[model samples]
Target chain A: MDLLSNLSLGFATAASPENLLFCLIGVILGTLIGVLPGIGATATIAMLLPITFQLEPVSSLIMLAGIYYGAQYGGSTTAILINMPGESSSAVTAIDGYQMARRGKAGTALAVAALGSFFAGTVATLLVALFAPPLTAIALKFGAAEYFSLMLLGLVSAIALAHGSILKALAMVVLGLILGLVGTDIYTGAPRFTFGITEYADGLSFVALAVGIFGIAEILRNLEGDQDRTVLGTSLGGLLPSRADLKRMVAPMLRGTAVGSILGILPGGGAVLAAFASYTIEKRLSDHPEEFGQGAIAGVAGPESANNAGAQTSFIPLLTLGIPANPVMALMVGAMIIQGIVPGPNVASEQPELFWGIIASMWIGNLMLVVLNLPLIGLWVKLLKVPYHVLFPVIMAFCSIGVYSVNSNVFDLYAVAFFGLMGYVLLKLRCEPAPLLLGFVLGPMLEENLRRAMILGRGDPTIFVARPISLTLLLLTLAVLVVMFLPSIRKKREEVFVEAD
Target chain B: MKNITVDWTDAMAGLIFILFGLLFGVQSLGLEIGTAFRMGPGYFPLVLSGILLVLGGLIVFSAIHDRGGEGVGKMAWRGLFFILPAPIFFGLTVRGLGFVPAIFLTTLVAALASFKMRPLWALVLAGAVTVFATLVFSYGLGLPFRRFGPWLEF
Candidate 1:
C-alpha cells in the first residue's frame, strides 16, 4: 500500500533468482548490441520478442526493460570510444565523448558516463515508483479529444525538433502517417491499403519498419563509405574518474537530470532530446564553453546522465497512460500485449508485482550494467577496432533475420526491404526519418480519436476546444509552431540542422 | 536544370499522392455501411484520401516558390540492388525452404549485397544461422516450424 512497502515487494519479485538471471542476460545482450554499431535496442528487442513469449509476464517485461535502458548505457561507450553513435540518443555524447577519447581521457569519459548513468537510473527508478500512480490518475481524465490533441502536439513537436528543412520534415511525417494508415481500421473494420494481402490486415509491423529504417538502412549507409573508420584512441587506461572530473560534473549532471526527467515524459523525443538539450545547457552554463568540442568531461557526463535518466523516465508515460513516448517503448508495449498484459492506468493496480518488479529491476539492472560494462570496456573497445566491412554484413544479416522472425511471414521481410529503400531515399534527400516514424506511429491513433470525438459530438468540431485538456494541448501546439517560425528560432534551428549535416 | 529536377521530384510526389488519393476515393465507393454517424468501411479511407489530396496540392504549390539547393540524383544503386531482391528471395523460398532456412538464405543474400564475400563463407554463415534459428524457435519456444509441404510436421 505504501510506497516503501510496495518497493520492498517489488525488490522481492525482482531479486528472485530467475528474474535476476534474465535481467543480467538482458543487459549483457543490450550492451553487446550497443557496443556494436548499427544494432539498436529497437531491433534487438524485436529480435528477442518471440523468445520472451514463453517466459512469465514479469520476467519478460523485466528483461525487455533491461535491454531498453541497458542499451542507453552501452550506447555511450561506442559514442565515446568511437565517433559512431549506436542510436540517435547518443549523438550528443559523440560530440564531446569522442573528443575525450581523442585526448586520451577515454577512460575518464567512460567512467563518468557509467557512474552518472548508474546514479540517474537509481534516482529515476525511485521517481517512477513515487510518481507513476498519480500520473496514471491524471491520465485517466483524458478523453478521446484530449488524447487526439496531445498526439497532434506530439506530431508537431517531432517535426519541429527534426534537424532538417521544415518542408521535408513535414513531408516525411505525412508519409509516415500514410504508412501507419495501411492496416485495417479498428473502428470501421474496413480493410485499408492492404491491397488484398492478408498479412497487411494487421498493418505493417513496427519491428519491420524500425529494422529496415534504422538497422538495414544504417548498414547500407555504412557500406557506401570507408570500411575502416575506427576511433583513434585504442588504449585502455584508468577505469575511474578523477576528483577534479567529479567536481566539474556535479552541476551539469543535476541540471541534465532535471531536464531529462521532464523532456523524457514528452512523446516522440525522449532520450534524443534529453542528450542534446543537456549538452546545450551545459555548454551555455560552462564558463569555459570553448573546451566543449575539445575534451570537456562535463559534456560526456551531462548528456550520458540525461540520456539514461530520460530512458528510465520515458516508461512513466507508457506504464501510466498506455502512451508510448518513442518507438522502443511502443515495442515494449507490444511485448506486454503479447504477454496478455494490457499496459495502462489499470496496469499498476491489476498487476502490482509486474509493475513494481520492473521498477525495482531497474536498480538491479543498472548495477549489473556497471559491473558488466566496466570490465568489458576493453572488449567493447576491441569491437570498435573491427573493420566495418566485416561488421556491416553481420549487422545486416541480423536485421534481415530479426525482421523476418517477427511474423514468420516473408511479407515482412519484403516490407523491411521496401522501407529500407524508402529510408535510404529519404536520407539522400536530407529528410529526417525520426519525425516521419513518430508521425506514422501516432497517425492512426490520432485519426481514430478524432473521428470518435466528432461522431460523439454529431460532427461539431467544437468539442475539441470545449474540453479543457484538449484546448490546452491545441494551444501549446499552436504556440510551438509560432515560435518555430520566429527568425531567432529559425536561425538557431538552421545552425543545429547544419551541424547535423 | 538542377532546380528544374528538384521541382520535378516534388511535382512527381504530388502527382503520386493525388493518384493515390483518387484510387482510395474510388475504392471507398464500393463499401456499404448502415449509419452515417457510426462510420462505415469507407469513412476513414475517404478522409485519408482527401487529406492526401490537399497535402499533395500544398507540396506542389510550395515547390514553385522553393529556393532550396539543387537536388542530385544520389540514389545508391548498390544498396538498392541488395535491398530490392530480398522480398523476391523471401517469397520464393519461405514455403518450400521453411521459415528457418528461408530466413537464413534471405539474411545471407542480404548480407552479401553490401560487398563481395566468399560464397563458402556466406553458405557457412547461412547454415549456422539456420541451426541457431532452429534451436531458438523450434526447440526453445516450440513454434511449430513448417518442415514439409503446406502442413507442419511438429
Candidate 2:
C-alpha cells in the first residue's frame, strides 16, 4: 500500500528469473542499437513491438523500457568515441564528450557518464514510485472534458517544443491526426478513410506506420550521405577519474538529476530538454564557464545524468494519465494497447504487478547497463564499425518480418513501404515526424473526449471553460501557444536547438 | 540585374500539405457530417482538413517572404532503385518462392545498392542472411511459413 511495500512487490515480480533474463536481453539489444549509427531507440522499439505480443505484458514492458534508457547509455559511448551521437539526447554529450576523448580522457568521460547515469536512474526510479500514485489520484478525477483539455495541452506543448518552424510542427500534428482517422468510425460505424479496403476497416497498422517512417525512411536518408566515420581515440587511456574530476562531477550530476526529474514530468519535456537545460544550468552556475565547449567534466556529467533521469521520468505522464508526452512514450502506449492492457490511472490499481514491475525493472536495467557496458566497451566499439551499407539490408529485413508477423498479412508490409516513402518526403521537407506519431496515437482519444464533452454540455462548447481543471488545462494550452508565437521566445527556441546542431 | 532566388523546400512542403488537405476535404464531403452535439464520422476529419488547409496556407505565405534555407538535396535515386524494389520483390515472390529464396534474392538486390558490395560478396552476404533469417524466424520463432515453396517441389 505504501511506497516501500509497493516497491518490494515490484522487486518480487521483477526479480523472477524470466523477467531478469528478458530485461538483460532487452538492455543488451538496446545497447547494440544505441552504439550503432543511423537507427535509434524509437525505430528499434517499433521493430520489437511485435515480439512483445508473445511475452507477458509486464516482461514486454520491462524489455521495452530497458531499450529506452539502455540506448541513452550506449548513445554516450558513440558520442565520446566517434563524435556521432547515437541518440539525440546524447547530442550535447558529443560536444564536450568528443573533446574529452581528443584530450585523451575518453575512458574518464565514459566512466563518469555511466556512473552518473546509474545514479540518476536510481533516483528517478524512486521518484516514479513516490510520485506516480498521487498523480494517478489526480488523474482519476478527470472527466472527459478535462481529459480532452489535457490532450489539447499535450498536443500544443509537443508542437511548441518541436525543433523547427512552429507552423510546420503544428501542421504535422494535424497531419498525424488526419492519418489516425483511417479506420472505421468509432461512433457511426461508417468508414472514414479506409478507401473501401478491408485492411482500412481496422485502421493503419501502427507498426507499419512507425517502421516505415522511422526505420525505412532513415535508411533512405542515410544512403544519401557517405557511410563512414573516424574514431578519434585508439587507446582508452586510464579508465579511473582523478579526485578532482569526481569532486567537480558530483554537484553537476545531482543538479542534473534534480532538473531532469522535474522537467521530465512536464508534457513534451524529455531527455533532450533535460540534457540541454542541465548543460546551460551547469554553464551559468560554473565558476569557469569557458571550459564548457572545450572539455568540461561537468558538461559531460550533467547532461548525461539529466538525459538518463529525464528518460526515466518521462514514463510518468504515460503511466498515470495514458497520455504520451513524446514519441517513445506513444510507442509504449501502443505496446500496452497491443497487450490488451489499457494504460490509464486505473492501471496502477488494477494491474499493480505490471505498473510496479516495470518501475523496478528500470533500476535493474540501469544497473545492468553499468555492469554490462563497463566490461563490454570493446565489443560496442567494434559494433560501431559495422558499416551502414551492409547493416541496412538486415534492418529492412527485420522490419519486414517483424511487421508481417504482427498481422500475418502482406497489406501491412505494403503500408510500411508507402509510409516509408511518405516519411522520406516529409523528412526532405524538413518536417519532424515525431509529433505526427504522437498526434496519431492521441487522435481517437481526443475525438471521443471532445464529442463526449460537447454532448454533456448540450452543444455549448463552454463546458471546457466551465470546469475548473479543464479550464486550467485549456488555458495552459493557450498560454503555450501564445508564448511559442512570441517573437522573443520563438527566437530563443531556435537558438537552443541550433546550438546542438 | 541582381539575381534573386527563393527557397522551394518549404514551398513544396506547403504545397503538398495543401493538396493532401484538399483531397481529404473532398472525400469527407461525401460522408454525413453531424452537428456539434452528436457528431458523425466526417465531423472531426472535416474540421481537421480545414485546419490543415489554413496551416498549409500559412506555411506558403511565410516561405514567400523567407530569404534563405537550403534547397532540396539530391534525391537518392540509386538508393531508391535497390532499396524500394527489394521489399516489393520479396513481397511478390515470398508466397511462391518461399522464405529462403525470397529473402535471399531480396538481400542480394538490397546489397547491390551499396557501391561497396561486390557480386561475390553480395552472394555470400545474401546466403548468410537468408540462412540466419530462416533459422531465427521460421525455426526458432516458429513463424508459420514454408521454407521452400511449391515451386521448389520439395
| Model 2, docking class | medium
A1-501: candidate 2 lDDT, tens digit per residue = 599899999998998999999899889888887777756678777766776667889998998888877776788998999888866788999999889988888889998999999999999999999999999999999999999999999999888667788898999999999898888888888988777788778889888888888877888888887458676646777777899999999999999999988888889857888999999999999999999989899999999999889888999999999999888899998889878888899999999999999999999999999898888887887887777777877777777777777777777877888888888898899898888999998888899998998989998999999999999999999999999999999899999888766
> DockQ for each candidate?
0.35, 0.68
Computed on alpha carbons, the lDDT of every model, listed in order, comes to 0.75, 0.86
DockQ of model 1 vs. true complex = 0.35
Query: lDDT tens digits, residues B63-139, model 1?
Result: 67536545636555675686556655866676777777666766677656655556777777667766776676667
* TM agreement with the true structure for every prediction: 0.90, 0.97
lDDT by residue (A1-501, candidate 1, tens digit) is: 699999999999999999999898888877777677665666556555555556899998888888876677777888788777777778888889888887788888888888888888888888899999898788778888888888778777777767756656665666677677777878767777788998889888776776667666666665665356656655755878778889998888888888888788776656877888899999998999999999898898888888888888988988897767776776786677657787778888888898899999999999998888888888877777776645554555555545555567778877877778777766665566676667666667767787788788787889989989899999998988888879899898888656643
Output the number of the DockQ-best candidate: 2
lDDT of 2 by residue, B60-130 (tens): 87887535779779776777778777767777777787888988988888887777777998888888888
Flag regions of model 1 displaced more than 4 Å: A38-54, B1-36, B64-74, B146-154
Query: After aligning candidate 2 to the native by TM-score, how far in Å is the CA of B59 from where it should be?
Result: 0.4
Question: What DockQ number belongs to candidate 2?
Answer: 0.68
- Candidate 2 ranges with C-alpha deviation above 4 Å: B1-5
